[model samples]
Target: MTALPDDLARALDDALDRVPASRLAPVVERLIGDYRGGVATVSSRQGPILRTDDDAAAYAAYRMPATYAAVHDGLSRAAEVVGRLAPRTLLDVGGGTGAAVWAASRLWPSLRAATVLEGSEPVIALGRRLATGADDAAVRAARWERTQLGAATTLPEADLITVSYVLGELPEPVRETLVDEAAARASTVAVFEPGTPAGYRRILAVRERLIAAGMGVAAPCPHDGACPITGDDWCHFAARVDRTSRHRSLKGGTLSHEDEKFAYVVATRAPGQHADNRVLRHPLQRKGLVTLRLCTGDGAIADRPVPRSRREHYRAARDTGWGDAWPPP
Candidate 1:
């Protein structure tokens, strides 16, 4: 269908620059190398999608900015919704170029240190470039903290832990371990998935596991004890990313192509840590014309801003800004 929203088109034009293609090239190759190997071709609305086997996966990885940002924004907001909770340490699992971590850091400057834990040499190397400060003489020998996560190992207990857009990528057993770890160690945990039905199912699975373990349910409010809103509706939010800094290849005027949508759940072990849906509902839901539901037994509803029409309402979904937003400065 359409590619992205108009605002996102403008944002990606700049934001992609931050992770320069020159930098992304190598990392993309590594991340997709195995999956693409021996494949003759891949298909999409983007034409033949030609690749000589080895290049397919890398190419696919490059095509995923919208999907990546969708889940990232969902988790980032999870951190923001509860900022009043004052978490001291923030841990980003499967951080990926530190996108979500940087998002949280900006919202919670009180954070002592932000640790982005990821595996993947080139990608993590790219992440280090952004989070690690200026380098110099003695610092010349310095290296960034990029570690491989394992089932046996224990992550340093933190007030917040986020595993965004990564559940789909992990093996079943490892995913189980990561979830269990978050339940035991983190004060709050938020995870997200695309708004697709399959994604909603996965988020539900996660919600059940975490709640069973004692964490309180937060987003996508559990409707009558069931999640994902019973209708064709989805829990989605838009992230506005600055364009030029992100490096945009080409634009077709409006970002009719970029639409990032996802379902997210926020859970916390500590009492009073859950975020009231009102803070978020005010921004996304329509006032008077619309209603808000915390996805709970009560299914609370309230008035908020709703776009002029269904079309405009859909268009208003915006989130992160790359750095500079429009017209590529």
Candidate 2:
């Protein structure tokens, strides 16, 4: 589970306080509709979805926590491999409201510099305001550049680059170009998307492009040959996000927490310690047996059952959760 830092959460709360939820509810609803209906076309001329300050506020209040949680989970997995590398800089493309920047700063305190590239003026304004309250100096001073994604776009060099929840909005060519540019510019790149079938497809495409760009798959996949997942299934994981009062109110939900299901891929110039097998889902525990669905190093999905007779392995299995590496690495 990943939760927003207290300072970041308070900053968001304070920002939301400036605008009443009652005034932002309809804007949030419209944004939700735009998300569901697809906000962008292949044409680069299409403007950003967030057109007003209220729209940006609604997004920051309602969507930032979930996006932050998802990006944090993805970055944690990446850190499992690249923690020792000690990345010192970050570049967040399409970083709406700096969610990815906050997640990165939370994971890698060594980060001394960060740059955010976003297209929307209102989104950038709100992002800059929220960043002023960030505890991480790098995040607070991050440069919010107004750059649109297209064929002619060039990415800045950084130790790490993150693209989250933005690829699905662009055309295929633009997405491919962005990934290729990131691969060329950064030592590590992490991309995140919603855990839908379509989102999974985008991630798969990104994984392929990254591999083709001479980078190694750093997390999720142990080997870089081919993805084992086939048919209707897709590779994704869930992060539990603790909702704030404002979050719940904006979302109109009673649940105190929500699971943010996400699909992501981390590729790096240098390979890290890849997991032997990744637990694919929540372990099913029976009276005396635990069943584990694993994606193995050889690119195959298998169900491994641990019975009580095997005390050591059973106990380990009992303690394991979804998205963990098997054998407790």
- Give the number of the best model, judged by lDDT: 2
Stretch of 10 with least lDDT, candidate 1: 320-329
Instruction: Candidate 1: count the clashes.
Output: 44
Cα-based lDDT at residue 39, candidate 1: 23
Clashing pairs in 2: none
Task: List candidate 2 stretches off by more than 4 Å.
Answer: 40-46
Q: Encode model 1's per-residue lDDT on 80-161: one tens digit a residue.
A: 4344555667777866655455444444555565666766655555445433331221111223366656666577787878
> lDDT score of model 2?
0.87
RMSD of each: 9.6, 1.6
